[model samples]
Target: MTIKKLVEQIEAKKSFLCVGLDVDLEKIPTHLLEEEDPMFAFNKAIIDSTHHLAVAYKPNTAFYEAYGLQGWRSLERTIEYLNERHPDIFTIADAKRGDIGNTSTRYAKAFFEDLQFDSVTVAPYMGKDSVEPFLAFENKITILLALTSNAGAFDFQTRSLEDQELYKQVLQTSLNWENAHNLMYVVGATKAEYLADIRAIVPDHFLLVPGVGAQGGDLEAVCRYGLNKQVGLLINSSRGIIYASQGRDFAEAAAASALSLRTQMQQILDAR
Candidate 1:
């Protein structure tokens, strides 16, 4: 999906919520295990229940990769279902991939052409060569990791090099790359305070923020500094929403959890 269409869905739904489908078999409802593909069954139920309350769905690749071939197939089926049934909603493959040029291009083709994800999260540690391959794809978004929600981010992301934080340098430098207009960023909601500075640098790009709810990142604080003219933020919630219940009403419970966040998002937009 294009940014214009994504923004339109946000406006129409009164939400910019991105539901993280980071499914873990051990944590899902046990009843779903009876299905041939438990993971896909769980995802389908959640999507069917909460599609109206979100503009995007992100499935972190590690979750699928951990389950081996079964997990990989589940991931495929999930994306295929979304593309065929909910094409209007954005899909992100949170694969955090980065490699040398040739390898990166193959990774890009796998996600952008084969799986058909609208966007994919990428690591920028390898710099321009590793990332531009993903950016080269027309209409597909390359969401680069900037300041993240993880505790270890301070190890390097905030480190000053020549008196400038590394992540700031990343944000500024990435803007000069080829097809930079297709760039979005991964800025953790836990790093909300730095968002004003982040916005000062890339005010127009969308930010995929993933530290709210279960991670305790304040939604109001994130929006106070993260919102741009286009409401450039995709606040993500994973375990908090999907694991709201492990009972038979799990899907309904997920919808309620998502609705709670979406209602708050609507209020934020309305007040703005």
Candidate 2:
């Protein structure tokens, strides 16, 4: 989907909620274990229940990759199902891939061309050559990792490089690169205070924010500093929503959790 369409959907739904599908076999409802493809079954139910409440769906590739071929098939089917059923919904492959140019090109093709994801999370540590390949694709987005929500982020991202923090330099450097207009950023919600500075550098680009629920990132704090004129934020919640219950009513509970976030998002947008 085009970025314009994504913004439109967010506006129409009164939400910029992006539901993360970080499904783990051990965490999903036990009853789904009897199904032929438990992972897909769980995902299918989640999508059916919460699709209306969310503008985007992000599936962390590692979850499916861990299950081997069965897991991969589930992911493929899930993407195809979403594309066919809800083509308007923004899809992201949370793969965090970055490598040399040739390798990055193949990775880009694998996700954007083969699986047809609207965007993919990419590591920017490799610099322009690794990221440019992904940017070459028309209409597909390259969401570069900036300041992340993890504890380890302090080791590098926040460290002073020259006069500026490393992540701030990253945002400034990336903005000057070719095809940078298609770039979105991955700024963790846990680092909400840095967002005003981050936004000052790249005010118009959408930010795909993680760390909202399970990671203890405050929604209000993130919105307060990160929000832009276009509602340039996709606040994500994975465990808090998808694993809201471990019983047969898991999907219903998931929808409720998602609706709660969506409602807050609506208020944020209205207030803006």
Error of 2 at 105 (Å): 0.3
Each model's TM-score? 0.98, 0.98
Q: Kindly provide the TM-score of model 2 when superposed on the true structure, using C-alpha atoms.
A: 0.98
Give the per-residue lDDT digits (tens) of candidate 1, residues 148-250: 9898999999999996999999999999999999999999888788999999999999999997994334999999999999999999999888999999999
Whose lDDT is greatest here? Answer: 1
Candidate 2 CA-lDDT value: 0.92
On TM-score, the candidate that comes out on top is: 1
Worst 10 residues of 1 by lDDT: 211-220
Report lDDT (CA) for all predictions: 0.95, 0.92
- Model 1 sits at a Cα RMSD from the real structure of 1.0
Question: Which residue pairs clash in candidate 2?
Answer: none
